[model samples]
Target: NDPLLGVPIPEVTSEQSSSMASPQSNVQTNHPMTHHNNKWTKDHPLNYIIGPLSRPVSTRLQLHEQALFCYYDAFLTSVEPKTYKEALTQACWIEAMQEELSEFERLEIWELVPRPDKVMVITLKWIYKVKLDKLGGILKNKARLVACGYRQEEGIDFEESFAPVARLEAIRIFLAYAAHRNMVVYQMDVKTAFLNGYLREDVYVSQPDGFVDPNNPNHVYKLKKALYGLKQAPRA
Candidate 1:
């Protein structure tokens, strides 16, 4: 017999067989199968693979496109005044207030007799700004003559300056109620919102800047109606 061919396979001992029957010993023997099963479980069909694979949809370009369109529209169609004269002419309503000021002067709302013995006379200034539409187009150039309310003393110049205004929630509830009642809510805006009200206190202000009368430079305006920047302007 050839020496290699005659060599016999060794039989497993009883100790070895007993060890193989234990769970811990079986783990070493089944290591490859265990690893394969773990991999299969991780890649199961029901697993949420898209969670790691998916990317967030980008909104940055959409916002940039909207912004570019807005900018283009404003550049092409905006109605801002090219010259100062055009801007001043757009505020012609300031001239109308001169008549009311004259009436207030006649009523002697504030003593022009002289500034009070020691008390300071509150000065006035004209404020100018451009009103714009929702689309960023200039609608009008508005001019307002206002008292320097900062100079006014709370107790001496005004009393109880707080005024009630409709809250946003109240306005929403009102709109809902109106809708339920089948009411059509019509909106109207007063051209001069403040000019509609008469001033209860004797309020005097310096003449408005651009629209002051050429003849009367020294004459200060005695306000007959509530102006835009009075300390105690009515909310209504």
Candidate 2:
């Protein structure tokens, strides 16, 4: 199911379907241009590059075709809005921002207050991405609000950062064991998981761009929990 749109996937006919069981049957062959035999003598400049004798020509042409095929859906995510104003120009982006902000509010991630004179407030930015299915179909548009942690001074804003991440070998071993046991692995993601981490440092951030509080436009948010892009977020 498509999470963002909630639209049912369109059914494909058996002839169009390509699965492990019948991979060779669905392989693309007999291109239209190849059948037409466009004029290009062996000695011609174009023929020298893409003639039947060119070993890499087929690979290069396939790559070009794949890139052209992805052109439409790639724009759905590869082109990201740089600012809140830019994002508002698109309805899908606006909805994605709203959903992210609502999640932050529900988690009680921060408190709005007057900015302290001496403290430096970290800036926030929006990031956009498109989620795809196993078969490379667009599934959802995802938006994330992240702090500009790169601007953070090392000793002042953070002490140390570390997080537990799986190693490839360990993952492979686990998968092998699972397969040996004839078990299915179930995976789940904790949405906004970073917000659940406790923040030890006194971190303050500028209000999120699009969802600023109307009553306190000048105020900043004092973070009680770790935010995405914070230096200590992964460790916290």
Candidate 3:
């Protein structure tokens, strides 16, 4: 065995020799500044960016797009009004409320009368909602005036409160029967719904905020038809 042939020579090659000559240059360890400069080279995804912390500040187009998507995010909304005062501030909400009142008038839901003595007048609450299309764009502004029936006594305001709705089991059974009979069941929604019901019990509700009749500011509404928040609304 040739010891010289078998033993590995630790001779520095051109690349190694150059590297050794100026270790700082060739074997480049990052300086503090350089480390910081290259530290965030990795892509920052939106999953980590989160909210207004690092939100895009590129262009007006982006700003407009951000507003459109603010429905899914952000603290403030443009359409939904939390209070009647707030609702009155926006024309759209005002129009929606007017429309709702118009519906009430058309359906003869209530009659304006002098404030009843010793009778409880349930306060009305205004709920403002923006109806959105399937694609997330707003379709219309919906305003609902609901009676606060919490103050109503069980026997006085209502004898029984029940929802006139089909059970899930019944619905499923009907669907199954339809399928078995090979009948194509057509679905329809009642546009519909509540105001048609006649209220047997006497229910008094306060006039809506920002819409109190100037002539009859002290007048209250005597509800003949079931309103949104009445306990007997669904059944009446």
Candidate with top lDDT is 2
Q: Clashes in model 2: which pairs?
A: none
Over 92-174, each residue of candidate 1 has an lDDT whose tens digit, in order, gives 43443454456446544443332234445567665555578999667754544566788777777667576677899999999
User: Which regions of candidate 2 deviate over 4 angstroms?
Assistant: 1-79, 167-185
Per-candidate alpha-carbon RMSD to the true structure: 19.1, 28.4, 12.3
lDDT digits (tens) for residues 50-160 of candidate 2: 435645434668988888878854674545777678777767888998899888889899999999999999999998877779987768778899999998988899998
Candidate of highest TM-score? 3
**Number of backbone clashes in candidate 3:** 0
What lDDT score goes with residue 21 in model 1? 62
Give lDDT for model 1. Answer: 0.59
Q: Against the unseen true structure, what C-alpha lDDT does each candidate score?
A: 0.59, 0.84, 0.81
What is residue 152's positional error in candidate 1, in angstroms?
Answer: 0.6
User: Residue pairs in steric clash, candidate 3?
Assistant: none
Rank list by lDDT: 2, 3, 1
Residue 122 displacement in candidate 3 (angstroms): 0.8
**Candidate 1, superposed: residue stretches over 4 Å from native:** 1-120, 210-215
Q: Model 2 has how many clashing residue pairs? A: 0
